[model samples]
Target chain A: MDRRDFLRLGSAAFTTATFFPQLSFAGTLPHGWLNGFKDNQGRYGVAYIDQKLQAEVLFHTPLRLHGIYKHPTRDLIVAPARRPDTELYVFDVTTKSIKVITADEGRHFYGHGQFNQDGTLYFTTENAYDEERGMVGVYDVTQGFKRIAEWSSGGIGPHQMRLYKNRLIIANGGILTHPDTGRATLNMDDMAPNLTYIDITTGQITQQFSLSEDLQHLSIRHIDVDDNGIVYMGLQDQVKNRRDLPLVWKTNGDTLDMMDEPVEGWEIFNGYIGSVSTNTHGLCVASPRGGCAHIWDQTGTTYIKQKDVCGVSKNADGSFILTSGEGIVRDLDGQNQRHALHFDNHCQAV
Target chain B: MKRFFLFSFLLLSPIAVQAAPSMQEMSLKVTEEFILPAYDDFAKQAHAQSELWGETCDAEKLKPAFQKTSDAWAKVQHINFGPITSLLRRDRLYHWPERRNSISKSINKSLADKDPASLDLDKFASTSVALQGLPALERLLYSDGLLDGDFACKLGHTIALNIEKIATGTDKDWQEALVNIKEGIAHPIYFESMDEVAIRFFTEMLAGFQMITDQKIALPLSSSLKKANGKRAEGWRSNRSTRYIQQNSLALMAMAKPFMSFMPDDVEKQVVAQFTVFARAANALPLSIKDGVKDEEGRAKIKKFLDETRTTRNLLVQTFTKHLGLTVGFNSLDGD
Candidate 1:
């Protein structure tokens, strides 16, 4: 089939098999998972996988998305375009429609964001590219998600933030890039990555923690917090030929410490952790380059081998749902479900 | 008798499925034919240079030796994983794209100190990586009057020895890695499967092309002729920047040959033809990369060559990923 026909068939399948049923809105919204994905025909979109594993493509766009976020108390989901791109898609579950959120002039989304407890305000990690600054863009959810205000992220490339009490914890990935160069890090020789926490109300920096000088090249990219208020980070080493560097770190709001390396060594992850998620059991970090998911708990570190695995989230029962670019969704029970969609970097259990 | 028969049957069984055998063959060929020999040659040339520097620190005699060692490095430098990645050996061998005058500053610091104890092999290895690599030697030899002093000559010899040590260690590590691959042992630092090995080689090949196009060519070429910076070119001091591209293209071709069997005949032919075109164009470039980027015609020629390199890389990415069924993960390939 031609490319158009293939995409048409995909949309038809989506409408018939998944979209129609979801549009009824008869009972309470079903529990589902949200992730950005690229279909077999190379179309980028966000998919909502229902409990039965039926994925409904809320919308497709030309921009590739990275992190998928769901509204706190509403049927709204947002998929931010990956860095160097200018658009973010906000999908309304009840209406089955999507609204485009454009980054302000001279700014672009870093593909991650979070909603406040009441969902009145939304915050996104963004890059003020022209100034080489990281920004936390606050949106007025009550005003049609308009760009309300922006705060300095306390470092360069801020990615993957989490809300803890009144603080917005940001992983300031120190690599500096301009859209002109298209994600090429300009300051690799001296990049200073830090974990910065800002007050949600005032956008003032509450605290910031940085790695030692030797480990300055480790970009603090992804963050997660457990029930104990301990924060975890997934790092991407900016330097090449660094095999022994740590990829996961944890903080107790005071000091940042590297986690113990898996018995197999850090080289297996190829120095990149695509996603980090925490559960009641413990922490799970996905390494897409390494094609493995590592779990750390009281039982020590163990890994599940799956090719191209990246997006990982905690299921309701505390078990992890792992997705991959190879279009496989795997659970801790060893069950594998195949799909025609290539899952992107981050997923959320909505 | 029945137990013995069952054991024999199990031993004779072929565990690899259809794609696995091709991947296994590709990995084995790449390891045995290309990676091992390339590194072995580098180690040999480095050791020879070190011995020559020890015998006589004359610039004339050592310059030829340095070029030989550098060329040998150009062949195997694309293999960035496994043993070469350990101990910062790769950067210690040739720290290029030296930012903020790091190499110059480090070299001057060492010269000012002039302490013999610091030149000891182990102590030197622990020193700044910039001073322990080929670039330091290049600066010492190619720059006028820099090596005339006794301490500077000794330092050059020490850098040669350091390169030799790193090259030898990397070669030995690759040998052990090959053994692990052959025995099907799950090496934590290297490969747990033949598929993984193939992917590593493929990734390196793509990265090699990218390095050539982006760093080797475009960095020096810059945007326009007026903005061209010759010193930005790698190996600009030795005037072998263009030669490095040719050598890298040839080495990548050698590494890519084993995977051709896994692709269709047309794809195999296209890849071969494209590599041949790119290699010839790269080899035929008359001026050094340092000189070539200075003028409009030269810049045009280099730009055409860069386009060809990118085309070749895209072809390889399309064909290799498709035929090998390798999902170059979106997140893994370019994750934010």
Candidate 2:
């Protein structure tokens, strides 16, 4: 659909009395945005929002999902349960059928995964909790999503991964946690977070970059890459009351460089960054803790003020679309809509 | 026609509405009545303790002052936002649940150093947080041979002075935060609205409860009798664990009073009754947290207190946010 058609549909939907207006042209929309949410009645579901901004709940489950991924060449979408959760939900958009994939024994999903260029293989960052190490669980998409192999993630607490060229760029959060202790970080004092690039063909780590000694407690948790191949990372600080620390960094060729703190200071983020996305505008990093999203570009940095804002993704026109826990969908162009759902951390333009 | 007109009039009639407390009013009440006072008390007690230590290293005179300072901290520790969170001051003031013997190792290193510059206040301020807080002070006062030498006494005095500096800075910072909160939308960084202020306060309050239940209580009260480790309790070395819990419960109750006017009458009643039961249980604890976790009879009492606290926390979570028309978001509360 073109921009004009999208605007027309948006206007028609805006006049409806209910919060979510059903669009007749939803099926005709080419692309959709997928996210996890909890409804007003406290039901967990994955929502699919089409090009015309019509949203539909694909399926409901007991697990609270985090990151979502759409198969590169298929109608399948996978939503992984957050860390320490063992379930991964696979939904086929065309057939409206769902498949539940369970993590291997003694391992759990870290809530993020990526598909290979041809879409034949799927890899998910996982925790080998019993062994106190991180692993990348590989699935053979051609063979009914079988768990074919596992590779060392090169560090502890491997979260969010991205496929760049022939390598998988993984954020090793470095914080140690176990299912027995819930989500508490067991090794904050000695955490050494890093960004690891693994060669997909060899299953070996090709390059890894870590922060300086002073920044050992900064857990690199989320990642996004701009069009120019600059990798942006969102960080979470394990130590409290250290608001002077930077929460965003970008890869500079072979090393990691901390981004300049905004004029307003790093305290505004409250020491956590939930999701990171890139668009024509720049790198958009969301901090649900600070209730805002910041766009960092070559010119400077600008922020959008929204309560509990986390999920962010790029629109076709190069603008950014943001979702919040208050059930609000917003864009940089000032279009706003609310639904009876509380959006989770990450959203993907499927 | 007359009956029809009367029915329409009744349908559109204005009903009497009970005005819920405004965000501005709630913020003012909480800040002025609870937060500021607690910070002031903490600063005062810390200053007194520092002065007493400076005058004499006598344990008998210094111990009571240390208790007063700790009690004041327990009252204000729940207010974890704003100025207190600026410079790692909170951890520097009382780093607890110490890991890998960090405190003792730092202390031993400091004690072995012969240079006079080692005991300098400016240099000590830059030391590991483990050696700059109440836990270190507790070790100095309660441990057997730590405070025998002049260097150890000087070290103790330096730590006390460091804590007082943090306490004073925090108190001053909160004064500025109060102005920002009162400014509401006018303030540049503190808060955007009164609702935002209330949400932050409520979230921190819930976090304080979780900390107490998870670390202060559950860590010491292990799963089974054989696994019980009394040393795990906060302030166990000073034998002030039970007293700290009591102070914390009382402080939380005091902080909660401002929100009562916003709740429905039935909810308010239930909350008050639950808090009463929780406070009474905290007060009735018969032994220190160290002994309570290890002894069978004392363990039962501590367990009952823990259960009461959990029940009260649940009641607040279910009612307080709903009545306040506020949501502590899942993403904001527990995002990866």
Best by TM-score: 1
Each model's DockQ score: 0.23, 0.27
lDDT of 2 at A226: 70
Q: What is the DockQ of candidate 1?
A: 0.23
- For model 1 the interface RMSD, in Å, equals 13.0
lDDT digits (tens) for residues A154-207 of candidate 2: 999999999888889899999776775456565655678899999999899999
- lDDT tens digits, residue span B1-336, model 1: 232223224324543424523566677778888899999999999999999998997898889999999999999877778788888787777776666778888989989999999899999998988899998999998988888788998999999999999999999999988887787566776666777787888898887886776567656765557656888888888888888888898888988887776777787898899989988778766469898889878887886787788788888888787777654776677676
Candidate 1 stretches greater than 4 Å from native: A1-28, A51-56, A227-229, B1-21, B95-102, B143-148, B175-189, B213-233, B236-243, B276-310, B325-327
First chain TM-score in every candidate?
Answer: 0.92, 0.91
Docking class of 1: acceptable
B1-336 in candidate 2: lDDT tens per residue?
A: 232223223334554545556777778778888888999999999999999998999887899999999999999876667677766788788776666667887788888884568667778777788899888998889888888789888889999999999999989977887876676543454566788788878887877776667667766765546656787777877889898899999988888887876778888899999999999999888568888778888888977887788788778787776676557876887788
Model 1 accuracy (lDDT, Cα): 0.80
